[model samples]
Target: VQFSDSVSSLGIPLNRIGTTQGVTVSLQSCTNGVIHNSGWTDNGWCGLGSRMFFQSTGTHTIRAQVREDGFMIDQIVLSPVTYLSTAPGKLSDDATLLAARVPVLTSTVQVGIGTNPSSGSTPLSVNFTPNAKLSGGSLAAYRWVFGDGQISTQGLPSHVYQSTGTFTTTLVVTDNLGHKASNFAKITVNNPVTKPGTLTDTFSSGSLDHSKWLASNEPAPGSISGVNYGSFVPGNVDLSKGMLCLRLQQQQGSSGVMSVGGQIQSVVPYSYGTYEWIMRTSSTSSTPNGSGSRVSGQVSSGFTFINNSQTEIDYEIEGGHPDTVWMTNWTTVNAKQYTSATLTAPDAGFYSYKFVWTPGRIDFYLDGVFVSTHTVNIPSASAYILVNHWGTNNSKWGGTATVGVERFLYISRFTYTPL
Candidate 1:
């Protein structure tokens, strides 16, 4: 905006003329197009309360550029203006402008903060988002002070507070006009309940590493009538398309006795850690003409097994109950304990199941979210990791496996981290 006047100072008048929330205006000398002053206002008309300065001006074009949307100009007023040598031409606050320039603005930008898992044990990880609204401007900068002396400038950040106590977190946002607003939130951190494990596995390769895995040729335990036991078939266990596919195929023995399924286990053993699997499963009901009797579904599982006293931790997807998952831990062959929850069947797609084994407890998770924690009879001995697809003779556990039937389980990735 250019104006011709004898007035020594300039006020290029501005207003919020539209519904668009944020609008910013910058005033600069037309001679060199250098910005002299800029400000933002949500309300209409001279909300900045300040004037632009130019040295000894005659007829000058003071450029008014909309740095943000929804700002409108009414007119340029030439008034007598002066600059203090102390602050130079730097932009002043609304209080300073009210004392030296036009009427004061009624409001400033509003800032707010939101967090996820807002409260948890110490060493808690929290995710925060800033919600700052500006009428005549956009966010130019962000400052986050996480109550604990740590700071960040990211719009959204995840931070882990290592100590236990209550803290007040603060956020400050600056607009294009150099206006700042602040907001704060309280986070309560308690003594950490769970520590992280040290081992992790994400299957990114096209084939399973033989050095890490071995097939199980033994029959499933606690066998029932009308069900065939499983033996490991190397060809049935394959890694292709970045997934480990374990298939249970009913095969007639050379003596004509049909086998139930297949299984694979880790070559190494882990005593205590966090173990996880991303997988899916598929099965079918037995045929009407039972060359051999088969049940409706199969048992697909990811577990840890030790033969010493037969210690185990099981993430078993029982086929008969399509949507339910069973979590079981055993200290001996005869002593078994379990809990269950319903989940969308993996056959529909992929799902994540995990368990954290500590000396005194076992924590279970589904898709990175906590599900259940078991404190009774947690396995203390190291065990080999195991994955299998098989059928039990009992209809209550796993539907019986029928001759000429097949079942499949696909594991895309397995991750283990020792605490």
Candidate 2:
């Protein structure tokens, strides 16, 4: 038999007829100058294996010679040694033999993305299209990781970048054979447009509005004014009785006492605004320790923050001193200024607390009355509005927690007016 393409090995099927004794046959490959002599005692067909590596793409020949009179030749088979190791014994069909003889050609797998308008201003919406190619394979899945902590599994996905920054969007594709390929695109967003508007949430819906706020779930627990303790968890936040409630508690863990806290922050950053909240500090009345004595070791806060730079403006009440509210502002972690305002009844009911922030100064007001003003260290950057209730170990500041006790901070309303 002759082949125009390369042949790595040859298979010869032979049978013996009208004889019980063995019949011998010789199969020889002319390309590699190798011969294989085989014999079969039974009457049925049998194959002889031979190695004849043909590296070049040219004509190859295999010659068969009968060594016994009873031996009858069937058909010649060309196959690679690697394929014959896994092929069926009978060598039944032409399609199976063809697949074994022809080498599989595999091209490189690739993935890419096309964005509608790659760069734009803040609050930009862009549609994405995935371009993927795989030779002899089909794409099975698509995963998109948008730079701003968002992900999608759709092939064609649209995303809105709310803040101004440079984001790298990536698309990962998986083929049917479990091969993966990934590609990335850079998206630039700038020129933030601050629309003058008002945002008010009264907690009337009996649930946290996802459109405006995101419940905090910190990856690990951290210390604020004391020892390393619990972290902010979304499970601790509650919206009921037309108010937002933040819970602080201690639970028994395998490692010892584990503290759990609650927090929520606005989805979008605000700049130059009057931020107001009708809220009350956490008290011992909610704890097993009962009222009269303040809930120690806890700090309840309503503040604005830009985390990367630690720029902030805050109104915080220490559970150890419920009658005093700390008003502070920070341009950075080291540069800060603060003052204390006396509260008439910190745990009795919700009181109006507000701060008007401008580029030059920030003024604090308690129950519509002027409390304090900060002329220096006023943050000029846009920041998220956050409310949190957490425990600390600092004796002079947050004090020590009464283990297994729970404390709560209640807020009836929150309003933000663009200045």
Candidate that would win on lDDT: 2
TM-score, one value per model: 0.47, 0.53
Task: List where candidate 2 sits over 4 angstroms from the true fold.
Answer: 1-193, 219-227, 252-256, 284-293
Model 1, stretches more than 4 Å misplaced? 1-204, 222-227, 251-257, 284-295, 308-310
lDDT per residue for candidate 2 within 231-348, as digits (tens), equals 8899888886457888888655555446788999888888898999998778645521235345667788999987644569999887667788999999778889898989876777
Q: Which numbered prediction scores highest in TM-score against the true structure?
A: 2
> What does candidate 1 score on TM?
0.47
Count clashing residue pairs in model 2. Answer: 1
What's the distance in Å from true for residue 239, model 1?
A: 1.0
**Which tens-of-lDDT digit does each residue in 251-272 have in candidate 1?**
4454433545667788767778
What TM value does model 2 have?
0.53
Clashes of each: 15, 1
